[model samples]
Target: MAKVFIYPATSLILSDLVARFGHEPLGAALSIRERIQTPGLESPPLQITPEDPKKGLRYAAVEVPSGVRGRMAIYGPLLEQSEAAIIVTDAEMAFGCMGCARTNELILFSLRQRGIPLLELTYPKSEEEGVQFVKAIREFLAGLQEGGS
Candidate 1:
């Protein structure tokens, strides 16, 4: 089965579809819940590793660019572990993380750099679009089953 990373990670629809298709969904909520429930953790932006500062910082401490690194700390691992990715844009309308513009750029850039099999979609507005959205997702995931680039 493929490890499919879903952007926003908290969407009921996407997660359900991925699981229904027999893939693991790497969602943001999963990451957040793991971090929050980990023993001894109090808050977010926790250190990924001891701060080196020379390399980019991953903790929620520190201030731009680096803050991006901090926030990405929570997210980057999920990205790295994925065999494929499904990113939904215009998700803010659906109460998903629109995230920082720069972070969006970074995430998209990193995904492209990794050259994984990727499915990019716009969140649906109406019933017809929703059908097309699911169709696209189903096709992409089925392609993964068949073997992907």
Candidate 2:
């Protein structure tokens, strides 16, 4: 199965759709879960270790904001692992909010640079558009399954 990275990384709907279509969804929920469940992560609410920022430096420059670096620490690895990706633009906060414009820009840039099988979709405003949105995603994913990249 292809490892598909969903943009926003926090969109449960996109994550579920990717998995339902028989691909592995690489997103923040799974990554954060690994941090939370891992032993020796002493910071409760922060859910980060000292090494997390260091890990992020691999993807982002040291001059970048620490918050962006921290976020990259989580998303960078997923980007590297992705065999394909689905990016939903203009999404509502309820859908998934990465909460940092700089980080968002960086993530999108990184994904584009990777040259993976990528599907870019706009967030649907109506039920009809929603149907088409999902159809497009399903078709793209199906193409990946058939060795289309």
Candidate 3:
């Protein structure tokens, strides 16, 4: 199964939809939740050693506007491991809000630079729009499954 990274990872609805379509959803919220809940690992999120915030500082060093480094630290790992990506551009705080604009730009830029299959969509407000959104995502994921771009 493809590891599809869904941006604004706090969106349970989108993440669940991705899983229903048979692909693992890679997102920061998923990792954070898993780390906090799992007993064998670190209990609180701040204690986790793998995704160090210091590394994010290194990532920011390459660019002039380095404001997003801290936030990127949390979200960048999933982006690196993803085979495909889906980003809801108009996502709200109800589903999930990316509080930082610079970080969002960096994530989008990184995804585009990767040149992998990417699906960019708007948040659906109505039932009809939601259906169409799902169809679009399904088609993109289906294409990936069939080895198409």
Off by over 4 Å in 2: 30-46, 146-148
RMSD (CA, Å), each prediction: 5.7, 5.2, 5.6
lDDT (tens digit, per residue) of candidate 2 on 27-116: 876323333454422222456877887888998899998878887888898888899999999988667766678989999999999888
Each model's C-alpha lDDT?
A: 0.67, 0.82, 0.71
Q: Tally clashes: model 2.
A: 0
Poorest lDDT segment (10 consecutive residues) of candidate 3: 34-43
Per-model TM-score versus the true fold? 0.71, 0.85, 0.76
Best model number under lDDT: 2
- Candidate 3: lDDT of 119? 93
lDDT of 1 at 37: 51
Q: Which stretches in model 3 have alpha-carbon errors above 4 Å?
A: 30-44, 48-51, 62-67, 146-149
TM-score, predicted candidate 1 vs. hidden true structure: 0.71
Residue pairs with backbone atoms closer than 3 Å in model 3 (clashes): none
Candidate 3 on 81-146: residue-level lDDT in tens?
A: 788889898865667655567777878888889888999999899999989999999988777862
TM-score, structure 3 vs. true? 0.76
Q: Which stretches of candidate 1 lie over 4 Å from their true place?
A: 30-63, 146-149
Error of 1 at 130 (Å): 0.6
The better candidate by TM-score, 2 or 3, is 2
